[model samples]
Target: MEGGVMKEEGNRLAKEQRLRKAVYNAIITLSECIVETTTLQRTLNNLDQSSWMEVVEERYLGRMCGFPLCTNPVQVKNAQKYRIDLKNKKVFERSAEIDKFCCRSCFLRSAAVRAQLEAEPLWIRGDEQVKIFDLNAENVRQQQQDTYDVEFVEDQQLITSLEILKIGDTAESDDEDNDDETNMDEEKKDDAHKEFYNLCQSYLTMKSAVASIDEIANDPTVKRITDETVTKMEIEAERKDNKRLSESEKLARIRSKYSQNKFKRPPEIIEAKPFNSELCDKVPENLYQDFKRILSEWCGPETICHLQLHRRMNLSDSENKTVTEAKSIIAQFYAGDRSINKIVEDVFLPPVDNVDQAKQRISVLVELLKPSWRLLERTLNRNGCGQQALEIISTFRLSATNVILEKKMCDLAVAVIFRLLAYCDRSLMDFYPSDHIVSSKFMKYLEQIRCDAKCYFGILSIITNKLE
Candidate 1:
């Protein structure tokens, strides 16, 4: 009885399992029919040079592949860009527009063709022939400019010819083989020679040397050193031309030299205390001293040294005192002490109607940063700065970015940005922020008050002038 019952139970279980399998198969078959009826897949044409497509930059992640015909999953490891390309027509739903291609084949087949982009971008192209022609012309012009020149600017830099250097570089080339090394054209070489000649000629106005056995006894550009000054009297006294002179006389001379050198050496400089009746007597000595101490805290000691704010270096006593007064005035301005005119008469401290008076206040600082501004301008205009520039005329000033609707000013701002990368590479201008308020770039533009300085300042003076 137990065998018969167990067999009947096994047969019922088997029938039920078979019925479940048949239902599962039916559902899968219906789903496959639905997919075949509703969907279409087009076989891609072979990718050739003429049919080649390039992926644009700025790929993004999406739930579905961006390619209109593709249904593949996007892999995180591979970045792909997609765009519709066939006849430049975009029929994909807006939601699917951002979806990127899952595979390289989809990208190659659907992305805008590199050749067709010259005619017009695939997604934006229309049946408008006029716009298409205009774009093609522009692209052709751009293609012409794609070739880059690899020439160096330093090649054009004027080398000082040590040969005939004192006489100046003439129309002659001394080295016959140097013709191969020379990089400049005829016009550039001529200009370089002219510039070098002019620099040498500037020293013509200097006075002749004093009569002395010393080779450079009175060199003006150089400070003579015995070290400092070997006096004419000392030079002459040291000469022992008469060998017959008594031993007592020679001993006396030696004794005199020892005593004089120890107790009464000649002064290197004539010392005089400067006293200006108008300026020095009225300056706030106590307040200015306090300002210098505070200045170091605010501006750091290095700034004081770089700008010579602590004391104007390399000036005569009278000039030194005058420059100290000017620096004090600048310090006062920095300290927000606007009543500088009350402290030092006839000298204005900003907020002045007279432009010259404004310039006079900061004349001392301009003499410091003229070289940095020069480097910025020259580097911007150089050949290998990675800029496709024919003309760049303006200062790299932050203030000029405020011009409203002026095309010329707009061009200048763009030029500054365009040249910035090149400027960073080549310019000697400091990129790091200056530590103190006094040495900051905001305070750049102290200028030389000479004809050469004026010529060099040129357009940049517009920015530097305000700093002065």
Candidate 2:
């Protein structure tokens, strides 16, 4: 009886010890689960920089209250106004009509309800009840048959080992057979355990590889870095495209600026005449007589003697020849009563050896005619012969080219030209062609000379005013 009691006590102690071990293991597993859950929550919070309160406010603002049993608006109000310390929680009160919660009470109640719903296990939720169905008789039988098959396989292995052992033993005793079968069964269990351990190790290795892949794929830092790199590449490409467009536009503008009037042709030559018939018709009898008197004085014997002395002193061989030819032509025009057109065409338009000869002949003519320029200007202005005077001056100016003039001569020429232009009709000025003195190229050349002279000239102001 004591032995039976001791045996019962031993069995009860072993059962109690086993139960204690299972409870300890359960506690450890629960603790580990809680740690894992907290770690996952922290990781998620770190990834999203916004606090839970801000997230909730952003999601629920201007929307209906989240509480299942309440109907209220949500609004963003000053957090300090709330009586509850909502810094660690997500709660807000109404300050306007658009608020989700009508009051602080409603917000708190909603939050509590949300927390309760989150805490409740899915299996215990009334709305999401899970119904477990029992296995049918055929399924139970199939499962049992599979278990029996596995046992049979193990037993077969044991039996084969026993048979091998028996072949090495000479004993035919039943006790020895039992012992050998037991040893074979133990060896088969050990082999099964080793196979299970190997399978578990392989499974753990595969799980670790999958977990590393997930970490690489889901890391926020990696994703953000990739996004920044793509944005930089796009920005660089855009800048390059903009730079290319700017360069093309700059080149186009430069071409347009320089080539604006480059291809324009020089003006055509017209019939030449010494006196304008239009001026003769407009001039009063008194002004016409004054003009003739001035012309006679300009061609008088004293002026002729001074010009001959000037030619002897300053004229080259070619220049003296040109001047002599010009004098003969003028004498023929006056003595033979030839038309002014014939004299201008034959005398002024004839080719010369060089620009210097042409210039010297022009200087001699200008010197001889200097006394008449002022008289011509006054007569034209008084008699409304401004257009005729301008035309005559422009023709004379065009006849002289590629010759550097003395400052005094250039000033005299510019002054005369400007005085004529000032009184002339603008329409008649435009009628003068491009190669004439009124053209852009001729005006620009005058401008360059004015700049070099640096002394202020009335011509500069006149030209600027006319151009503007």
Candidate 3:
């Protein structure tokens, strides 16, 4: 008994060791499988980060076959795939490389349904069939030969009966006497004559009424002038007569009444003597005569004499110095002096607060200088004084710097310079070369002035081109 018990214990020990070994092997195998699966999962996740991998996932992963009644997952498996051509009503087998339905049964089922639909007659679901049947019945009834034949036969019978009745009535009328017929015809003629006479009377009365209406319509005096129109005409006529008489009679009466006054000679007139010699000597000797002439032309002799007398009275006081300076400048310029810089300094340097007033003053001076400049140009050209003309132009060009600071003065200066250039081109080109010293100086001054202000760049360009 002891030996059996020991053997049983040993057997139990061996069974326990075997069971433990099996359990340990199972645990190791499960751990290795888990590590392999995790590594594969990490690899798949890394691949899914790429765009093409995502497309592959969408193409195959979690996508089912696009086939009717198909529940199989689309994959590279044992099933044959196909594509259904709905337009051609055909089914074609596709390679496993293509992404489409996975099963041939689905394609075949779809094709069978398409063929069945094609084999069936075209169907209308509303009352179209009933209406078509009714139309066909109506057409068949119209096409039956008996229906129209019967209607035509009845019409012919009715027409024959009407003709027979008309013949019988004619025969009965023929049985009557010709005298009765003649009496009836005479009665009809009398009635016709009476009606015609009545119609003729009515026509004549209507024609007379129409003629009277036309006469009334054709009357010229229908639209007589209103009282207002007649009054206006009378007023106009009276205005004309009054104007004629007033003009003629007023002139005649004035001539008759003031004839002595018109012909009367004034009391013996005393002419004022010329300006005092001391005052005349104040102007330069060469310019005195021209100054006196210009002063007389600009201001009358009486005014000039008054200015001279005033100057003489205030000889020591510089109160009205501008008037004297203006007189001297004008005199000097007209006397063939081209000292425009000094003239501008004297005339244009006095600052004016009012721009409009300054512009007005500049405009007045420009107008006054224009005639002198024109006369000078003519005299210089006639005497062939092209160099003197250029000197005068240079003086004006230097003066334009001060003038161009004002907008209006700049525009006027541009116009005057353009005119001067034209005059020089016409009158002085024969004497001077294209790139003469005067022309170069003038162009340089023009470029300088143009740079200083934004004025007449176009005209400057044109002048430069012409000079070049």
Candidate 4:
């Protein structure tokens, strides 16, 4: 009884399984028919260089492939496992496997070709559009420029108005204020320019050591070739000299006969007497002192002579004061008695025999001038003898050695130095030694006179005039 029941159950189960299989087959067949008629598969004739396409090899299984030959699961159409034989260009849609053939890759290539063709028109259209846009943009830019030119003056006026409004809010609204500051700056610059001009002018005034500078520029003779060229020329010259020398060998042989002649040898040393303190003592004390003082006192308004004299005499400050007092007494004596021209003549061309005599002459000159200058000042109201008197006073200051002389000498030295500076060449100013005592003293004198740029420049002009 159990065997019959079990056999019946197995038969029923088998029938049910067969029925399920038949139904699944029918559904697949209908799906294949639907896909075949739907025209879902496409062929591309002009594939673009870069595009994506899918090639179907099987339906329902979703088997596909692509160019450069890739396979993935894809759907098939027409109840066929579509396969591509790419070399043949034939589409096979069936459930049969073909040798060395892929449906997908061929379809993909066709699709890509079709896509490339389709996109060509769109790319051409885009490029044309860009060109048209560029032309329009250029036209617009030109129109804008024309418009700007038409309204240029108005625009400038508007800008000026805006600037004026902005300026009104600032502290520096006054144009004159700006002008004043500008003038100040210009004045400063002018002063500097004048100084430079004065320097150049002064150089022009003075005698130029480089007198041949311009001639050197213009002269063809000045330019020379290289040393090697000169050497070559010399060699050629030597060759020419040697051409004559060959014939002179006979003369040379004649001269060789006298070569044995010789001259005398002289003694190396000679002796003389030694000592002479008595002769040294023969130099008179007053003479020595007087001789020294001329250079010390008489260098025309420059106290450099006096300062140098003191230094050379090696006198202490106290001794210098005594010397100065004695000198003043001599100057005063000459001033009360002597004539100005006589003093002037005496100061420069002193008796050269003794220092005391020279001192006496210098004293007479200074003394004669001092009171005469004062008298000239009093007498010459309309005439310009005051200038001569001033000059005389300057000369007197150099010789006189009192407290008054120190200040007066300093002032006079300054005047003389400045006056001389005007006559100095520009190159000298640029290259002369600043460390030199005379130069330093001269500059110090300029500072003392409070000489400004214009005054110095006037002096320069005077110098240039003299030179011209």
257-296 in candidate 1: lDDT tens per residue?
A: 6655556678799789797765522333343234223222
Off by over 4 Å in 3: 1-266, 271-361, 377-427, 431-468
The lDDT values for all models are: 0.36, 0.43, 0.42, 0.41
For model 3, residues 1-468, the per-residue Cα lDDT tens digits are 999999998987776665445434323332221224333222222111122223323434446443323455665566557789999999998754234446665444433322222221212111111111111223444545455675333445445544644545645666766554445566755665576566557755876676676575566664344555788999999778657786778678667865465565689989998879565323233332332232223232222232233333344434434446766656555545444344445445445574544344445445444544444345333433333333323333223323322332332343334344434344343323443323443344434333221233333333344333
What's the C-alpha lDDT at position 342 in model 2?
A: 39
Candidate closest to the true structure, highest lDDT? 2
How does candidate 2 score on lDDT? Answer: 0.43
- The residue-level lDDT of candidate 2 at 245 comes to 76
* C-alpha TM-scores of all predictions: 0.14, 0.15, 0.14, 0.14
Which residue pairs collide, candidate 3?
Answer: none
Tens-digit lDDT string for candidate 4 (1-468): 899999987876776565445434433332342323112222122121222221222232333332223333333434536878899999986544321124544443434333333343322222222111111234455655786785333445445544644535434635546655544555755665566566556656566565667765565554454455788999999777767765578578568878667877987886777888666434233432342243234443233332233233333334324446566446546544332345446556445565555356445555543543343234322233334334333444343353123323333333433343322223223322432223454444344434343444443343234333
Per residue, candidate 2 scores C-alpha lDDT tens digits across 105-202 of: 55554343233222332222223322222213344445557867843234454455556455345355444567655455667557756765665577
* Backbone collisions counted per model: 5, 7, 0, 25
